[model samples]
Target chain A: MKLIVSVKRVIDYNIKVRVKADNTGVDLANVKMALNPFCEIAVEEAIRLKEAGVASEVVVVSIGPTAVQEQLRTALALGADRAIHVETDELPEPLNVAKLLAKVIEAEQPGLVILGKQSIDSDNNQVGQMLAALAGRPQGTFASEVKVEGGKVLVTREVDGGLRTLSLDLPAIVTTDLRLNEPRYAKLPDIMKAKRKPLDVKTPADLGVELKQHITQLKVETPAQREAGIKVDSVDALIDKLKNEAKVI
Target chain B: MNILLDSIEKVVGSQNVLRGEDVRSRTADWMTKEPCLAGAIVRPANTEQLSEVMALCYEANQAVVTHGGLTGLVRGGMASSDELVISLERMTQIESIDCVSGTMTVQAGAPLQSVQEAADQAEMQFNLDLGARGSCTIGGNIATNAGGIRVIRYGMMRDLVLGVEAVLADGTVVNSMNTMLKNNAGYDLKQLFIGSEGTLGIVTRAVLKLHPQLTATNTALVACEDFNSLTGLLQHARKSLGGELCAFEVMWSSYYSLLTTESNRHTPPISSDAPYYVLIESLGAEQKESHERFEKAIESAFEKGLLIDAVLASSDHQREKLWAIREDVEGLAHLLAPRFAFDISLPILEMDKYVRKLQSAVSQRWKNAKVIVFGHLGDGNLHVSVATGDASDETREAVESLVYEPLKLMGGSVSAEHGIGLKKRKYLNLSRTPAEIALMQTLKIALDPRGLLNRNKVLPDILA
Candidate 1:
């Protein structure tokens, strides 16, 4: 069985990000970029399946600017067999990216397709479900556990109450949760080899999908300033302030 | 074999199958646990069937291991051959992103980056971050109480989580997805799983608090002549930068030089020869004002003789290069063979003396052993690496004792950001008191009566 994993490039969450002055968006001129955390988990899960010999080949794909190919390279380094980069300078919206990814999925025709639940930069959780809908496949979202039995996929989902389990047919979309698998670091050797791996670069024109930006940024501004409160002399005074002023008691 | 396979098939259906060698990969975590290893791996799709699966496992006395994004430094998720591996790879979904409430409710398997992004999309920020944010699950972060660079400004994973839902050892679902920031109703059951490292129960979902996104950030690389100067700079930055002071990371000369060596990508910001270097950052609403204040703070420190030399990041590229010096620990990792990485915390006042004493002790014992130190100094946390000339059982024990023994007297902790996995299990007592240790064991037993979840971790062995 073949597995296709979708990943995205995002700002490293550890570094505090600031929106640009023009109110356009976050300043990404020289920001430290990385693979979206959930997407990395998705990639790790796919690679693990391949390593276990359950999956024949792991193919990674991403829809973004040419720069996103770096994230795909990272996935390849982590043990993906090849990658597909849907090159677009502008990330139009969740639905557009999903549409592009669905096209890639149809072409690859992998047994399983995995995606991060959301992207760190956009936090749009619609892509995976949208891809599932576009692909006309059942989705196992927020999966905590996944097992392949006979010809069906059993997925354990982390839900409001607890873990919920379900079964889906083959050729399904599974969005990875954090607990899926610990992603392994790409060793130096693997990083070198990933450069030589097959990377198929496609464009919106090639996919025959029209890119559309659904959301427009009216203004991007920082949160209101948090004033420095008076330092209490003692615990009793602190409690009084918390109760009276902050009312966080 | 058919009976076991048949039982699993009853819950997940015929297609979800794993047997024999396929089970080995899921059996053990990084630390390698024995008894709770997976005899099979059952992947259930939703909560109801997972409950049924857990019920079956509990009835059969078969230990079940819940797996999420496995980037945990600790072995809390490791399974054994007699157990079953229940992976959450399919349950990754963002249930909701509440903009008004400033919260995001997500499945336990959702990656930390995914939650952070969801918060970002809502024009809010999830303050919980770490090096493993790309691969680690929010559940694992909660389980480990993960702390990253932002711990100084936003606190740890414990501070970010409003509520959680987890499955007990017996597969009983405990849902406590509280969205309110101030919910003091009862025991705060979410606390039980927040830092327990997945031993008590398997966390499946969480409601995490979010903050408004910052608009501006100012970063700098400064050189300190001594520990006193470092402390002085920290105080001045805290007072002058006001609430905007977000990060104050320190790097020893040894660490800085190692990064700036010929083969490395980073060039020394100042000289790579200072006794100590600090990477300071401030995030605020006004970039112009924050930059002005940052400049003034450094100017004041320089006048007061607290700083010898300082370089403000003029451009984003320069700023990144400066940070690369601090974040690149791989240089030190390469230089040292058989290195033991230690993350510890001590009171700010006691840190200098403690480091000196530990260095002297290590030198006396090993002669050629090198100790490199650096960390988030603002939060009193330090990451120490001891590269030994020889790797032996006795050498390891001696090095550990020398490094950890001083921490006890200085009222410091053995494991700071990193949880006490198998590596630091024996040294737990160096930090926690006997009464605290006893209470921890009691909680472990009370919650996991069968000792099935992440056994023999985070706590020391009981004395006879």
Candidate 2:
């Protein structure tokens, strides 16, 4: 069995993001970028499956411009057997990304596909479900734990209230959550070896996927600075202040 | 000391004064973990309270040892059974940050890590960093004139500190807290207390200079087959990275292999086959351009045969892993216990020959001795640890001779950044001339007349 993991490059969590003066979007000119934290979890899950002998290979895939290859190579260093780069300049929507992933899935025919629940850059948690719909396969979203045995993958998912267990048939899609697994540091020798790993790049047109934009971002602004709260001597003062100042009563 | 404890308790409050087991419960230093042998531990709330306590001690002629984080390796904070300990643990307040002047005003007891974090929160860098930052205090850093990984770029703690407020032996508070860069009006009085090891005066507060926070940091672990290439690479990096180059740490093969062996926790990032591994770090203003420049510089170095192999950290996580291998001082301590650790510095050109000569001398004395060397090579400092199976006083003395004797001829220092504390006080003459020692004595006698402050620590005792 083979496993396919999808990753995305996003702004590093350490960076203090700055919004453009025009309020159109966040500035990304010279900011540090890394594999999305959630995508790292997805890559860790796929690599763990391969290490456990449940899967024979782990192939990582990413879609973006040339910079995305850096993240793909990072995934390869973290124990992915190979990498595939779906090269495109424009940022693609969830449906288009799902279409591109479905094309790669058709060609590779992996037994399992793991993806982050959402990319941190967009926070639109629909790619896994859309890919499942396009590929016609079962999906376990927001998976905390995954166990594969006898041609079936048991996924324990984190739901609104508690964990929900689902048994997906062979050749299923599992979207990783925060609690899936912690990623390991790439070893020195492994990193050297990753440079030699096969990374095949193909254009989005080669995958029969056309980029489309459906949503228009109007403006992006930083949240307003919260005003300091005042102290009240008693509950009566609090009630009176809330009613008069806040005007909520 | 007992006569002064009453007045000390009155000034700092009784609960702030600890005695017997309350005092011994604390460790003497960061490394030894020995029971503190002070008569009483006094925790003053602020600089004024500490001044009052020091006044009482001075009147009684009581010997006192100033404690700041207790992380010094040279037994600088060690106190005897009859002496009192004036611990700065409670005087840790960050007064304010003047962004316009680019300075942070902090109490002496503020931990180095807190100061660094505070500066970072203000979008500024403190510039002084070390392995013991979490426990070491600003006062101690100032007292020792601490130098760490970035000294090559940012200068030492003496350069980082703009001014200091200290209390003298007779409890005279000298508040020379000048926050300007160019204050040459008269004698820079703060220099007297900066690296005196708490022997002249106790630093109560300091105004530290801060630099703009770095946006991009590029780190790489490169291998050099020979010492010449290592020095060559350092010069090349200095020429290429210029002011942006912050740290250039080198680990000898013995140090690297021992810490990164298969059984060790760190997997060797680069094969431990090379004679030297240099951890090169550069910090810059722009991320994209700095990264491109770093890559180009490294590629050119490789092409010029200055480095045999290299691994550039692709992400922040990878960068930390590479640093972990370099900062594995604990791993070295555990592996080479009963070791005599020496922090010495010389001309960079003499380091290779010095280490080789010291290694042969150590092995000749003890056949099974393991001599491990690694440090901030860019700053001309190397931390050499030698273990010959026994930690006896005779063995320590023998090893110390093997390490310090050669440094005398090379015009090197016995104590590089650690200072001439109790451990290296005997060998102070090796690093300083007779006139320098006499002048140091004159200053010590002038400042601390009764020798009540950190007695017999940094300066040697005057013979009767």
Candidate 3:
């Protein structure tokens, strides 16, 4: 069976993101970008299934500008069999992307479609559910554990209180959570060979789908910095400040 | 009484002074797991504030122990309840990076990791690196004259430091902040404080020299069948690698195997076999040509019977794993408890015989004792550790005597990189002559007449 994974490019976690002076968006000039953490987990899960011999092939897809191919190549380096880049100037809304993915699913008909719970960038948390609705398949979101048997996938999802388990038949959609698996480092030898892997590029027109946007972002800004706190000399002083200065107690 | 505390508070605002439970909350040093024994710790913001604080303490006849990251291998940063700590924790600031001069002026307390990162951003590096870079401070490195993995290419901390700003015991600030490569103007005052271990003065700030960041770094771990092969391989690397040879670290089979196999330790990239393993690294400008030369060097070493097996790290991830095996010795702390670590400098020719004799002597003393040896073979520095399964005071004393007893005859110094703290005070005479000791004492009396700045360290206490 074939496993299709969705990979997205996001800012590297170690870097401190800078907000633009005009508040247009994050200033990404010359900043290091890497595969989204959740997406990496999704790729890792797909690779595990392939390693277990349950999946014959793993194909990773990314939808964005030309630069996003870097993330696709990284996924290939990490053990994905092949890559497909749906070329577009900007990422579409979750619903439009779900429609585009649905078109790809109709053509390829993969047994499992794994995606990140949400891209760290934008963080819509809607693509997996929308894709499941468009494809008419059972869905598992925020999956922490996944087990596969004959014709079914048991997904343990992360919920508010604890984990909840659900069983979905094959040809299902599942989004990965942090605990799905620890991603492996792309080995040097594999990275060198990943450049040779097949990477097919196409536009939304090639997939017989039209991309459209519904929501418009007016501006983006960084969160306000918290004020530094002062240490109190004693418990009495702390309580006094809380009652009079902080005015909360 | 609170009078002295109030005086110190006046010097460096009341909030900067940490006492009572706060002092107890901090660990003594990187090695000691126990709470610190300090009357109070004053964190001055910059050089002026530190000078004022020192003045107040000096007038009160108080003993002040300067504190950095507390990552000293020797007990140099150790303090007792009678001593007050002048911690540079609050003075952490990378004031500026002068690209033209290739220098960085930093307050004494900035962590080495951030300094390295900042230098990297400026397309340069301080080239003073060690395993403790994450936790240690630039001040501590300067105070100890730290010699790390790259000493072969970039010399020790003393060579990297261009100038230093130190506060004397009498609270006088001596700022020799020179940012030039060639400044032969009079006596360089920075040399006195570089490796004085805080006895001469408390280092408050420093102007550190930086080097152009090397674009190409090639690393490999090779197995050596014998000591002669290790020497031959070193010669081969020196010839083939040219001036790009940066690090050549040798780990004896005992330590290499122990750390690689220890629980929570980084697994070795190459199989742990043979009597020794040498980690070779070369950094240069041309990546392709340097890599070719490095590979050729290793291949020639193997062809000439200088090395048995070799594995090159082709990626940063692979290189980091090989380095982790050397840097994360703390992972084996549980198995090697009650260990004695010695950083000794001796002739490279004397190492093989010295190690064999030391191991034999330690085994005869403790039947189950294990000797783990590793260090920078290029710098004539050996870090020898002995674990006797006992951390008792008697065991520590016995191991110290065993390690230092033969050093005098070999014309070796008791310490190579780590300065003599309270731990090695008694062994000072073994390394320094009586006249040299007298001169050191005379200078100590002349500069710090009160004998308060890091007293009873690096030199033997007066024998009444």
Candidate 4:
């Protein structure tokens, strides 16, 4: 069984993001970028399934401009068998991305598809469900644990209060959460070999999809800096201060 | 001694003086996990309090050892049963940071990691970093002139320190707290205590130089087939990376294999079959351009046959993992127990031949000894450890001879970054000439006439 994992390139989580002086957007001219952390978890899960003999191959796909290939190469180094790049100059809306992924899924016909629950950049948690709807397959969203048993994918989802288990048939989609598995560092030999691995780059038009921007961003501003709070001696004093000074009672 | 302890208690407060079991419970040595044997441990709140306590000790002719974070490999912080320990544990305040001037005024007892974090929070960096950053104190780092991975780019602790505030043995405070980048007002008095290993005086506070924090970091673990290629690769990285090269750590296959394969403590990032592996790093202002330059350097090194195999970390996590393998000193110590660890520096060209000769000498005596070698090659320092299943004093002396005797001819120092504390004091002659030794002795006598501070450390005993 072939496992397909979708990845996205985003600003590295370690960077302290800066807002442009003009308030246009984040100042990301030379910021460090890496595979979105959640996407890395998804790729790690797919690779583990292959290592466990449940999946014969792991293929990673990403959609963006040429810069996204760096993330694709990273996934390949992390033991993905191959990669497909749905190249476009601008990032598409979630619906359009799902459409493009649906076309790739049809062409590859993988038994399982994995994706991060949301992209950290956009924080849009709709792509997996939309792709499942487009591909006519069941999806297990916010998966904390995933297991393949007897031609069925068992996914344990982290919900509002507790974990909920869901069993989906073959050809299912699973969106990874925080606790699926910890990713492994790519070995040196694998990184060198990843350079030689096959990476097929195609346009969104080739996938029968068109990129579109649905939401308009008006302006960006940094959040207000929090002021340091004073320490109160006792609960009664804290209550009195909160009620009288803060007027929160 | 009891009267002296009582006087110290009065100066620093009764609660600050620990006696009996409290003094016995604290650890004195990091390697042996030995409990402190000091009769009493005094915690000074600040430089003034410490000076008053020192005066009391001086009046009574009491010998005292200053304890920071007791993480020295040379047993420099060790205290005897009759001695008193002056611990700077309570004087750990970060006084102030001059962001415009790029300097931080910090108390001595602050951990090195905390100072680094503070600098980082202020958009600057403290370049002295090591495996023991979490536990080692800034005072200890300053005392030993600590050199770690980044010494290739930033000089040792001496270079990072702008000024120091120390309490002399006779209770005189030398407040040479100069915060300027270029100060030629008079003799640099701070240099006396910078690398003296707390023998001359106790460092109570320091003004440290800080650098602008580099936003971009590139790391790679490259394999070399031979030592020549490894040195060539270092030169190539230095030239190609264009002074952005921060670290060039080379690990011998024997050391790498022991930690990764033999002990199974670490996951080997690359095959340990190569004769050598180098962890190269570069820091820059911007990400995209720096990464491009880093990649070009590595690619050219490969094309020039300076490296056999290489892997560039795709993310910060991967970069840390690559560094973990190089910084596995605890793993090496655990696996090579009953081992003689040597931190020596020689000319880069002589390191390969010296290690081979030392290995043969060690194995000839122990028959099945293992010699592990690795260190900051860019700084001409190598940490060599030999395990022969015995840690006896006689065996230790023999092994020390095998390591230190050859360095005299090779023009290498017996102690590299780890100062010549009690462990390497006897071998000081191997690294220093008679004139240098006499001058060191004269300085020690002039500064600490009564030898009341950190006695029997960093200096050998006078001939009877």
Number of clashing residue pairs in every model?
57, 0, 0, 0
- Give the CA lDDT, 0 to 100, for residue B259 in model 3: 83
- Where does candidate 3 chain A have its weakest 10-residue lDDT segment? A184-193
* Tens-digit lDDT track of model 4 for A1-249: 999999999888777788899998888777889988889999999988888999999999999899999889889999999999999877788998899999999999999999999988779899999999999999999999999999999999998899999999989999999888878766555766888999999998887776777787789899999989999889999999989999999
Model 2 chain B: weakest 10-residue lDDT segment is B262-271
Tens digits of per-residue lDDT, candidate 2, B276-374, equal 999999999998778777877887788789998888776687788889888877878888887889999999999999999988998998999999999
Report the Cα RMSD per candidate.
21.6, 5.1, 5.9, 3.8
Best-fitting candidate, scored by TM-score: 4
State the lDDT of candidate 2 residue by residue for A48-132, as single tens digits.
Answer: 8888888899999999898898889889988999999999896688989999999999999999999999987789999999999
Chain A fold similarity by TM-score, each prediction: 0.92, 0.94, 0.94, 0.92
What shift in Å separates residue B16 of candidate 1 from its native position after superposition?
4.9
lDDT of 3 by residue, B1-464 (tens): 25777987887899998899999999877776778888999888888988887888888888988889898977887778888888999878999999888999999899998899899888798899998888888898998898899998899999999989999998999998999999998998899899889999999899999988776777888889999888888888888899889999999998888887655465665567789999999998775577668767777787788887777664454577788887766865665876878999898888999999999999998999999999999899999999998889998999999999899999998999988998888899999999999998888888788988887788887553
Instruction: DockQ each candidate and list the results.
Output: 0.01, 0.25, 0.07, 0.40
What TM-score fits each model?
0.63, 0.85, 0.76, 0.89
Q: Fraction of true contacts kept, per model?
A: 0.00, 0.20, 0.00, 0.39
- Lowest lDDT sum, 10 consecutive residues, model 1 chain B, at B27-36
lDDT of 4 by residue, B108-191 (tens): 999999999999999899999999999889999999999988999999999999999999999999999999999998798999
| C-alpha lDDT values of all predictions | 0.80, 0.90, 0.86, 0.91
Error of 2 at A175 (Å): 5.2
Sequence-dependent TM-score of model 3: 0.76
Q: Which stretches of candidate 2 lie over 4 Å from their true place?
A: A1-5, A14-29, A37-60, A64-69, A72-96, A106-126, A138-249
